[model samples]
Target: MELQLALDLVNIPEGIALVKEVAPFIDIVEIGTPIVINEGLHAVKAMKEAFPHLKVLADLKIMDAGGYEVMKASEAGADIVTVLGASNDLTIKGCVDEAKKQGSKVLVDMINVKDIATRAKELDALGVDYICVHTGYDGQAAGQNPFEDLATIKSVVKNSKTAIAGGIKLETLPEAIKANPDLIIVGGGITGQDDKAGVASKIRDLITQG
Candidate 1:
C-alpha cells in the first residue's frame, strides 16, 4: 500500500519543512484543499520543488471546469489531482480525459456523494485512476468515519485503486491498512501534531511492510 500524508493548513515554509522531514518515508505528499486554496497552485509547485522524488497530489476539490482544473494542477506539479464525486458525469469525465492527456492521474473523492456505491461504479467505468473514500475534516470532528464507507465502495469498484482519508492516526492505521486500501491519507493526525517525521515513519512501517 502507498501511504500519503496530507499536509493541510501549514504555510509554505512549514509544508516544505514537513515534507523535507517525511518525504523520504512516505510514498506521496498531499497539498490539501485548504492549503492549496490559501497558497494557490504555488503550493503544489513548492511541494514538488521540496521533494522531487515523492508524488505530489493537489486536493483541488474541483466542482466545475474539470479540464481546466486538471491542466492547472498538472502544470502546478501535481501528479494526481482530485475532483468531487458529486460532480456531474460530464465534469468527472472531462477531468479524467484531461488527466489522461496531461499524463497525470485523477482521483474522484467521494466526500458528500449521496450514493457512494453508484458513484464508485461510475468512476470505475470512466477510468479514474483512484477512488478516495473520504470524510471531510468537519465531518471527522462530528464523528464520521470513512472506514466502513471504504469497504462499501471497495466492494462496488473492485478494479480501481482505493484510498481512505480523515481522522487517520497511528492507533487507527492498522485497521485501515487491513482493509488493504491502495493508499491511506492522513491530514491533521500528522500535520497537526509534533514529530511529523516520526509520525510519518511510524505510518510507513505500519502500512507498507506490515
Candidate 2:
C-alpha cells in the first residue's frame, strides 16, 4: 500500500512546508480540491517543483473536458489527475487517453457516485490508473467513511488499483489496512496532529508492515 498526504486547506507554501515534514513517509502528495480552487494548478506545479521525487496528484475531480484538464495538469507537473466517477464514460476515456499521452495518470474519485461497484468495474475497464472510494468532508461530518466503499470497489475492480480516502486516522488505520487498498489517503489524520512527522511515519510503518 502507498500513503498519500492530502493538502486540502493549505496554500502552496504551507503545503510545501507540510510535505517536507512527512515527505519521506509518503508516496504521493495531493493538491486537494480546495487548494486547487484557491491556488489553481500552480499548487501542483509548486508541489512538484518542491519535491521532484514524490508524485503530485491534482485533485481536480473533473466533471467535464477531461482531456483538456488532464493535459493542463500534466503540463503543470501533476503526476496524477482526478476525474469524478459520476462523469460520463467518454469524459473518463478522454482523461485516460490524455494522461497516457502525457505520461501521467488518472485517478477516478468515486465520492458521490450512487453505484460504486458497477462504476468501479466500468472505470477499471475504461483504463483509469486508480479508482478511489472517497467520502467528502460533509459525509465525514455526518459520520460516514470510505471503509465499506473501499471493500465495495475492491470486490469489483479487477484492472485498476484501488484507493480510499476521508477521515482516516492513526486509531482507525488498521481497519483500513485490513481492507488492503492500494493507496491510503490521509488528510487531517496526519495534518491535524501535533506531531505530523511522527504520525506520518507510523502510518507509513503500518502500511509497510502490511
Candidate 3:
C-alpha cells in the first residue's frame, strides 16, 4: 500500500512547509480538491516548484471540461490529475489521452458515480492510472466509511490501481490495507494535526506493516 499524504485547504506556503517536512517518507503528495478549487493550477505549480523531487497529484475533481482541466494541471507540473468517473466517457478519455501526452497519470474519482463498478471498469479500459474510491468530505462527516467502499471498488477494478480516501485514522488503516489497495489517501486527519512528519511516518509505517 502506498501512502498518499494530502494537503487540504491550506495556504500555499503552509502546504509547502508541510511538504518540505514530511514528503520524504510519503510515496505521493496530493493537492486536495478544496486546495485546488481555492488555488487552482497555480497551487499545483507552486507545490511542484517547492518539491521538485516529489510526486505531485492535483485533485482537481474535474466534473466538466475534463480535458482542459487535465491540460492545465499537466502544464502546471502535476504528475497526476483527476477526473470525475461520472463524466462522459469522451471527457475521461480526453483527460487520459492528454495526461499520456504530457507524461502524467490520470486518476478517475468515483466520488458520486452511481454505478461505480461499471465506471471503474470503463476507466480501466480507457487507461487511467488509478481509480480513486473517494468519500466526499460531507459524506465522511455523515458517517460514510471508505474501508467498505474501497473493498467493493477494489473487487470491481480489473487493471486500474485503486486509491481510498476518507476519514482514515490509524485504527482503520489496517482495514484499508486488508483490502490490498494500490494506494491509500488521507487528508484532514494528518493535515489537521500539528506534527506533519510524525503523521507521515505513522502512515508510512502502517503501509509497511500492511
Backbone atom clashes (below 3 Å) for every candidate: 0, 0, 0
For residues 38-89, could you state the per-residue lDDT of candidate 2 as single tens digits? 9999999989999999999999999999999999999999999999999999
* Candidate 2 lowest-lDDT run of ten: 150-159
Candidates' TM-scores? 0.97, 0.98, 0.94
User: Given candidate 2, what's the lDDT at residue 109?
Assistant: 92
Cα-based lDDT for every prediction = 0.88, 0.94, 0.83
Cα lDDT for residue 138, candidate 1? 79
- The reply for model 1, stretches above 4 Å from the true place, is none
User: 2 or 3, which is superior by TM-score?
Assistant: 2
* Candidate 2 ranges with C-alpha deviation above 4 Å: none
State in Å the error of residue 117, model 3.
Answer: 1.7
